[model samples]
Target: MFNLFGRSRKSNLRPPRAPGDTVRAKDLAYLQKWSASRAGVEGFVEPETIVNEMSVVFVDGTGEWTRRRIGGPKGIDAVFQGTGVPLYFAEETGYPQRMRDRIEKDRIVRERLKQRERRARLEQERER
Candidate 1:
């Protein structure tokens, strides 16, 4: 047997709802509906619609967190008024990178499930 050395890569997985924009199907309607009535904000670059799946992340110097679905600026604005944390665009703030990684991890999990199904089918064929 020939052996080729390769490192087994480790994966980091975080729970969806500990904090930050962890959006579910039920929450999306509210975000979309609220953003629908909002006008474009002058200085920031935002997606055309704030889908419920989208997350708004805000952090202050005091180490507190503020996160929720993309319910237009209004959602973040309300959260900010008392919280005193400023909302920054995830794309510009590098939060998008975290989001991108999460999406990639989810895709990998789906692919792994499909592979399991294929292996099960192969075993069934062999038994037949």
Candidate 2:
């Protein structure tokens, strides 16, 4: 028997949490830190996908963002209600452009730093 692309036909299964299951304490702590940051934040409930768990993302007005897996949508709403900020379904609002821009800026900065480090190392080798 041959399988195309060497992929299994079995469904990838994840155990669902019970309805009464509580959200993780660490997730709550992260949410708290983001809420208390310099700028106000908005919450987005991200749905479960094949490669990722159900999670929440908080994007501050200044474009700072954090994301973590949470128990479920209800648990996310319950946890963030105390923040007094608007919460939206990821499907409804999608991700904010500011968050995307912030991530891109960080990536560029990191790449530039790496190039500088590599250049310094090459210079040191040449001087040896």
In candidate 2, which residue pairs clash? none
Off by over 4 Å in 2: 1-12, 15-22
- Please give, for residues 22-118, the per-residue lDDT of candidate 1 as tens digits: 2343544443443334433111223323223345543322222334554344445443443333456656755444345656787899999999999
Query: After superposition on all CA atoms, what RMSD does each candidate show versus the true structure?
Result: 17.7, 4.7
Candidate 2 whole-model C-alpha lDDT, 0 to 1: 0.75
Backbone clash count, each prediction separately: 0, 0
Score candidate 2 by TM-score against the native. Answer: 0.79
lDDT of each: 0.45, 0.75
**Could you say which candidate leads in lDDT?**
2
- Considering summed lDDT, which 10 consecutive residues are worst modelled in model 2? 9-18
Please, what are the lDDT tens digits per residue for candidate 2 over residues 1-128?
A: 33676644443445354255445776777688778874768888888776566777889987888877776656766666656667789898888898899999999999999999999999999999
